[model samples]
Target: MAPTTPRPPTMRDVARTAGVSTATVSRYVNGLQRFTEATEARLREAIDQLGFTVDPVARSMITGRTHTVAVVILDIRNPHFTGIVKGANRKAQQLGYNLLFVDTGERQSAEAGMLRELSRRVDGLIVSSRMPDADLSTLRDLDKPVVFFGRASQVGVHSVSADGRSAAAMLGRHLIDLGHRRIAYLGYGAARWDAERKAGLTDALREAGLEPMFFSADSPTLEAGEKSVGEVLMGSARPDAVVCYNDMLALGFMKQAQAAGVRVPEQVSVAGFDDIPFARFSTPTLTTVDMQSEAMGELALERLIELIDGTLDASEEMLKPRLVLRQSTAAKVRT
Candidate 1:
């Protein structure tokens, strides 16, 4: 009898062809293992010849849970989001959850796209913006768990945020206490946050028979801050003290004030929020508010897990912000 041609190859056959153990072949075939390009190509060739197919039922049995938490943020450049991620990471590792971060870069379309697919792949989600409220509501309506970070809205499935209103309020009160009657607020975020903080400032100012000059901006980036301050300093009316959205913007404003030959805390004092890592080292040793970023992150994760496991109802909690005084603000210089 002529030699029989080889019978159709099996997983074992492919494993042998690829010179790897059966376990390695199984991992590669299931996309559970990561290997070098060369090894993956060889495995692909072996599988192609063997005509291997993964059992759907068996795959499901191996992965009991989706094992992923999707973190969606607008601008990763913002440290506020970073703090939240750190908190999520800590809690996720403790619970054996994998974190998958996506930077929407503040794009509404991308935020929408990510939501549609992420709902399918992740066990839960932590979103950081407001535009996807309707999509998130649908997910909640369908029993999917999602939490919003930083910004707050009633429609979010679950929301996590610091007491930003109170934080800004604290800053506002500090300025008022310093006897800064002609104050300016360099603000960012939605009208809601701005309004709340400004309300706090207004409340305090109204008590003191004063009002704040407010400037609204698209964001708290350094350039935006620089321009905002430059314009004010050049104008006929200028604030004696300026409170900024974040440390970066605050730093920019301070730089601009000095460039215009204004003495900080003498001609005009500047302050910022978030007290980012570099805040203390800045030239004037910035006075600012602490949003408790890491704590915010840790709390968010703790809350998200509870919500996902049906242990906690959706709720909103605020963290109290603290004021760190340095060389930035002092008794108003004698005019």
Candidate 2:
């Protein structure tokens, strides 16, 4: 046969090339049709050669599945939340799901509505922050799967979190190991997680027959860290070391110490949790515990997928944290 100039392809063209019906080609493109490997490969190749394109909106109408998962996050500006988004987005793509990110911007009512609205369209959901007042009830009423990360839910809810308890323990033990007899924990002191972390710190202190000095902060802001640490340092006796709730707070405490003309390690030692990217770059760096943000996201996404597929039971899964020692921590020195 003489060489023939191939015509640009359409659904019919793809079907003819693949030796399948036009309807078959259409269904395959819309993901409404299942196919054998050979048939799928042939259709795929034909479409590629023809530069075939389908309107995703139309495809969604036909298939009834957008292949999208909505990820509702609180404050994308937070480094930790950003890390979870990164991991969840990558996994969503790997699993053939599109990401529809909704930032709550840290508003309770806004998050609640966005969550409910997103839940209606997405095949599943992954929420990064604590569910707002009605958010949990909404998730409970949702027909699709939902998984929470770093934030916990009700008794029956699914959550993936780093071992908050262990994180405190590691930091505490590290300080005790350095012969710091008196340590303090400073953070948003009343939160459930904060309490758990404090327990771990006290546990570590008890193991070494030491006592921990605690100064409760209203929040984890750097200002709070600075003020709290200042009070501790100004007390009758200064703690040999202090463990902060997170890197941000730790950095603040470190700054306060510097301004107060205290010699670090020689006068005071500081440890922090949540080894955010900035933790390693901080001045004098920081001795912190890594919450394994990416790993937490991965596990949360996996758990969401499982809940969607009905492959695994919804449950709380905790990943352990690791201690990161840097220039900021050293053996205690009596002033």
Candidate 3:
């Protein structure tokens, strides 16, 4: 004779054992309605005895809210992205939501796959994408509330970003005023945000009746910055000052400069973007732009909540950038 398996518990079994209507049990369990203390005690006792647990899939089906969000970042290793993720996670938890983060490793092709998979499991999305407008448009069409963290799109997606063009122009003007004419721009290939900063620098150079020597790094990395320094120093027009894409690149160039016995600010003044934490503590502290990345992340999460609740109206927000003066940059030395 084979032993029969024990019958699995159900909501009905809980309601029957507790001597309450199924509707009352359902409402009380889901927190949509309350019952008398006596009824609640009976239900809890029944649930304990039956070992009943609410299945998340069933709960989601009933409430129509997964209470989960997906955030896609370009590079998780970057401190700038770390700040954004921290802000977003804090804000999301306060709003009764959990975050699932994905790193694209700066790969454009990976974005589509991440979106396809995560969109099915999360209630909303927050992305700091480096993809083109055409490729990013697919995300807006996913029928899920989405908020862009850094870049804005023409597809009318909600976004939070810094005015990098103006910030870069300000940095460029500062260098120009400090008597730096033969300036070189060190950065990776074309990104809209990068393009904006480059345009600002180019316009500033044009206004000063000067031209820039452009050096393209393979990627936004310390190694790229180190390798690009050789190109900048060996070029026909040696730059008196250099503007790097971000702090890592700036530090890399500074490292190479030190090894080559080139004095910072004295021989080749250096500047960078994204005033990360170590920027202020680095040897000859890095002069860079503060993009308020954490605030951007918090704002994006707030906007995403509004979107989920159907209260959002504006499609975009632009945060301000500030220039931080540090020891890495100074008036060019006359040599």
The clash count for each model shown is: 1, 0, 0
Kindly indicate the candidate among 1 and 3 with the higher lDDT.
Answer: 3
Per-residue lDDT of model 1, residues 186-294, tens digit only: 8776523555666766676777787888886676677777777666676788888888877778888888788879888888878887778777887788898887877
Q: How many residue pairs of model 2 clash at the backbone?
A: 0
lDDT of 1 at 65: 43
For model 3, residues 119-195, the per-residue Cα lDDT tens digits are: 88988999877777767787777779889865554676788899888888888898999999998888766555788
Per-residue lDDT of 1-335 in model 2, one digit per residue for the tens?
99999765579988888899999998888766689999999999999988887766877788766778877776666677678778888888788778888887655646656667788787788876544334466666767788876454563568788888888998888888887887888866434467778899999999888878888776666777788766888889878788887777888889889888987767778888778898888778889888887777767777787787679776778888898999888987655
| Cα RMSD, model 1 | 8.8
Question: Each model's TM-score?
Answer: 0.77, 0.87, 0.83
* Top-down TM-score ranking: 2, 3, 1
Where is model 1 more than 4 Å wrong at Cα? 1-64, 132-143, 150-153, 189-192
User: Which residue pairs overlap in candidate 2's backbone?
Assistant: none
Model 2 error, position 116 (Å):
1.3
122: Cα error in model 3, Å: 0.2
Model 3 reaches what TM-score against the true structure?
0.83
TM-score: model 2 vs. ground truth: 0.87
Residue 253 CA displacement from its true place in model 1, Å: 1.4
